[model samples]
Target: MAKYLRNLTCTALFSMTLPMTAAAEESEVQDMSDPLAVYTQAGLGYTDKGINVKVGQTYDTGSDTSMGMNVLEIKGFAGEALGWNGRGADDSIDSIRFRNFTVDLTNGLGGQVDISWDFDSNQGSASYSFIQALPKMGMFNFYHSLDLG
Candidate 1:
């Protein structure tokens, strides 16, 4: 019975050593000589850093001079104005807005005209112009275009 117990103890000890040896062989040893190792160990990557603040302003100027015909005759508008917009990192601040603009019925068919500009992260600034005939049409249809930059 003593001999049997001794054999079992030796087998168990040998089996434990095999797993330790295999694990050591399978694992790789990293080179700590790299300068950025310390930062990497502290859970920092390429884009990880401090607060990033972005601020800027945008200027836009446009002009239109045309005497064209749609389904009906249309007048023309010729004016010059300077406009600017201030922005922050996100849209958490006020955006580009037009205030106190006057519209006069100089000639031709009277319609509803709307001009809007918005900012987006992926596609940048977008400007939209829409013109629709007033209560003349129930379907509410006219001409529209979008300028994405």
Candidate 2:
């Protein structure tokens, strides 16, 4: 509430102190008519949910432990990526994700997957974790794969 009040006060003060501009200059600020703006923000590359696609080959060694032998597998998916901003100081919002992921069992890690994200103004005490059943690690149950901030 205090922050809201402060912002409101500042906006009101700015409006009152702004110097008057010529009519021709004022006319230059045209209202945007882009219909998509109604759905997303003023300028953005992705919609409420950005897109991500991955396709990779998975080959299981004969000794996968309790899971036993496995065949060649491929995984691909698409999900919502709504809360990230590239322009401002504050951009990452909260989101929920549900999907199936795989970790390769191949030696020397035949493939590499790189996932990147950015956060601004870190004020919240949040904990993030990724869980997966690792056939590569010889585990039949899901376990903490990684921890994120």
Clash totals for all candidate models: 0, 1
TM-score of 2: 0.18
Candidate 2 residue-wise lDDT, 1-149, digit = tens: 67456545543443242222223345355322311111112111222223222222223334442111111111111112222232332223323222222333332112122233222232333344443433334433233446554
TM-score of predicted structure 1: 0.18
| Residue 40, candidate 2: alpha-carbon lDDT | 16
Expressed as tens digits, the lDDT of each residue in 22-85 for candidate 1 is 1223245632332111111111111111111211111121313212211111111110111111
lDDT of 2: 0.28
For each candidate in the order shown, give its overall lDDT on alpha carbons.
0.24, 0.28
lDDT of 1 at 92: 26
Task: Give per-residue lDDT, candidate 2, residue 36.
Answer: 12
Clashing pairs in 2: 49-81
